[model samples]
Target: MFAARPYEDVLMDDIAQQAGVSRALLYRHFPSKHALFAAVYQQAADRLLAETKLDPTDSLVGQLVQGMDIHLDYFVANRHAVLAANRVLAGDPVIQTIMTGELDALRARLLAVLPLADESARRTVSAVLKSWLVFVQILVVDWLTEQTCSRTELRDICVGAVLGALRPLLPADLVPNWPQLAAGRAGA
Candidate 1:
């Protein structure tokens, strides 16, 4: 019931009535509406994170494409819930901390898969990856709102852009494969 209703509309009485429980009982579990809303946001974040799988064997570009696809899939499928969580967490310090930690963990996971030879290269790659991830997020949100293209088409464009940017940074073997991928994607 809470999930279906807007956070502001989910009064204790409404939840209690929906659950066939007294208001006091609901209060016993969650002290306030904000606490209950936070719990819902945390659960949603956890579920979304669990749904994202990273393949260790894939190249950095491949892994990024996979991650982007998963992210877009989640956003497309759960737009309302995600937008609700975004609104609730936007100004919440505790939620910001959690979000930062989650992003750091994801960065570390990607770093683990990337082949950085030197400290400078590692730092440079990390910065690029972080920026690229944010760019992808913004692009996805814009694409969603505009309905400018199919998700697969948007994904291809995003993937192509990132791969093009990373080409100079990658080894010869990887560099050659990118053009082929770009050509294949374009032809599709």
Candidate 2:
């Protein structure tokens, strides 16, 4: 139902019938449609997070570039679910809380791998990391709507944005060889 119609148009009865379950059974598991939607959103979000995880062997730059591709691919494949999740995100406090938690987890993961010299630089990088996460989401949504650039172009731009934003805060020794590390890449 969600695939064919907007989230608001999906009725509990339709879901129950499609799932070969009674409405009472469905309600027993998910008290409301909003709850059921949130559960699905959680699964999608988890998949996104899983895909975005950094490979332990990759450099910081490599991780960033890889994550950009993973993020964009997920958006491209799950556009409808992403749209519905975004709507639920705006109107539902429970979903909002779950997203906040996911953001915090992402932040923690970035901080763990990001190379900064001191607590002060780490704090600054942390802020930049969070802001860049939000920027990626906004840029992808806009790109999906406008088709202003190809996916490769979008990935290049996003990776460049993240590296450029963090360059000043990162230690000189920690900086990767941009031209060599991500050579022939659109953003590199």
Candidate 3:
């Protein structure tokens, strides 16, 4: 329903009818449409986070590329659900909080792997990672909805965006292997 129409336009009666449940039953389970959307978003976010966990043994670039792959895969596989979630982003505080919290967890995981010299450097890297993640979400939504780019191309673009952000902050040794890492090899 979200893929076909905006969440605001999807009536609770329509949802209950589609689910073959009585309105009373639906309301019993979810007091409001916002509650239902929040439940859906939380489930999807938790699943994605679990599925895309970073490998501690992989190089930073490799881990990033793999994580991008996981995200793109999930988005593609659950296009309807993802689109629905995106449409409801403005309606509910609980849903927004769930989305933000998941993104923050992802940022923290990536920051842990990045090599930084001090608290200030870590802060800078974390900020860059968070900003790039927003870009990733937007781009992923666009790519999946528009079918403008191949999956591999989209993944490469995401990897490039992150690597570009980290270039000046990362060491020379760690900088050269980004492309290779995107191709499924670890950087030295």
Candidate 4:
């Protein structure tokens, strides 16, 4: 129900009917609509994170591309839910916490796979990634609404942005080859 309709337009009774459960049971589990949305959003986040595998065998670029693709797929599918979380529930603490947790988990996964110079470099790169992820959220959310560019272009833009931001910070030898970056995404 949350995925198919705008947050404001969805009613508790409708959700109960859709679930084939009594309104009393629905309210028992999730006291309110906001609570239900939060739970659903968290479940979606968990699924996305699980699907985006950060394998050590793959190139960093490949993992990045895969992660972005999985997320973009979800964002495109659940457009309304995302808008509600990012716009309508933007100020809500629970929703914000869920977003923060997902970002932190992703950052941790990237850090695990990233070729950092040392602990100092890891710290710096972590901070940079934090900023980059937040930028991605804001930009992608806006893109969902306005759609100023193609999805492929938007994906490339995000991939390019992070690579650009990390280029100067990363050691030369540690950096992935840029020329062939886009040509072979899965192997890159």
Give the TM-score of each candidate.
Answer: 0.77, 0.85, 0.83, 0.93
Give the alpha carbon lDDT tens digit for every residue of 1-188 in model 4. Answer: 78788999999999999899999999999999999999999999999889988998887677788899899999999999999999999999999999999999999999998777789989999999999999999999999999999897788788888888888888765556654666565354
Runs in model 2 with CA error above 4 Å? 1-5, 173-183, 186-188
**For this target, which candidate reaches the highest lDDT against the unseen true structure?**
4
Report model 4's TM-score to 2 decimal places. 0.93
Question: Any idea what lDDT model 2 has?
Answer: 0.76
Candidate 2: Cα lDDT at 90: 68
Q: RMSD per prediction, one decimal? A: 3.1, 2.7, 3.4, 2.3
Ranking by lDDT: 4, 3, 2, 1
Ten-residue region with minimum lDDT total, candidate 1: 80-89
For model 3 the TM-score comes to 0.83
Scored by lDDT, model 1 comes in at 0.69
Worst-scoring 10-residue span by lDDT in model 2:
179-188
Clashing pairs in 3: none
What tens digits encode model 2's per-residue C-alpha lDDT throughout 66-179?
A: 777777777787676566766545667877777777777777888898756789988888899889888887787778768899887788777778777877777755565554
* CA deviation > 4 Å runs, candidate 3: 1-21, 177-188
TM-score winner, 2 or 3: 2
The CA lDDT of each predicted structure is 0.69, 0.76, 0.79, 0.89
Going through the candidates in the order shown, the clash numbers are 0, 0, 0, 0
lDDT head-to-head 2 vs 4, winner: 4
